[model samples]
Target: MQLEPDDSQSDRPVPSLAAPEFAAGDRVRMNALGRSRHPRYGERQAVVVRKVAANGWRVLFEGRTSLLTIHRDYLEKVEPV
Candidate 1:
């Protein structure tokens, strides 16, 4: 007797582009520098994990996970850090 094979896991399609919108608890990169309290004011590397306002976001800096509120003008999408 002969047996038949199955192929049921190769019919789904993958996404091409992602939607534009930053949410809380999301990891993102700093694009530009707008304003800050630090002496070294500028687009320093950081992560987005909180939403402060309609066009604002809270990010976590290197070596730490503390959320820091910042405006959208001070952020830019970047590769995972």
Candidate 2:
């Protein structure tokens, strides 16, 4: 089943406390804060930032090999090893 877009969330800015702006080659990890559709829900992953919009970010996950639009709350920045 496809989920419909919620108009109330359109063009909303991400809270500063939740997530920071990421560059093209930034490393990030998914937080285990809630149930996620991702297979690696709480694992570290490399991502290339396609774009950052007021609503959220468009990113490509290297590990999962999927491009996804995710909310800032679902991501957390991690330093590259």
Candidate 3:
């Protein structure tokens, strides 16, 4: 049997904190302070590509792979190694 989702609770997305602005090529690290964090991508340094939302910025991490949209609060500026 399949279970149905609860309709009583609101399915609206919770709003996150506003993110700081970053220019292209700014190095940053993902802070482990929020929800939905992956161990493989844990607190890794990334480069800011652009802003996707008021509190979300599109970043390209060190792996030189896919881009991720992370909230500003979860990102901190980091210096190059």
Best by lDDT: 3
Off by over 4 Å in 2: 1-18, 34-40
For model 2, residues 1-81, the per-residue Cα lDDT tens digits are 999878988545435564566767777766654126455555756575765676466677665777777776666778756
Sort all candidates by TM-score, best to worst.
Answer: 3, 2, 1
Lowest lDDT sum, 10 consecutive residues, model 3, at: 11-20
Per-residue lDDT of model 3, residues 1-81, tens digit only: 999988776643345455456888899886665334556767668899988867788999897788988778777788667
The lDDT of model 2 is 0.64
Model-by-model lDDT, in order?
Answer: 0.57, 0.64, 0.74
**Candidate 3: global Cα-lDDT?**
0.74
Q: Candidate 3, residue 52: CA error in Å?
A: 1.1
Q: RMSDs, each prediction? A: 15.3, 7.7, 6.6
lDDT of 1: 0.57
TM-score of each: 0.49, 0.57, 0.63
- How many clashing residue pairs appear in each of the predictions shown? 2, 0, 0
Ranking by lDDT: 3, 2, 1
In candidate 3, stretches whose alpha carbon ends up further than 4 angstroms from where it belongs are 1-19, 34-36
The candidate scoring highest on TM-score is: 3
Which pairs of residues have clashing backbones in candidate 1?
Answer: 25-49, 31-76
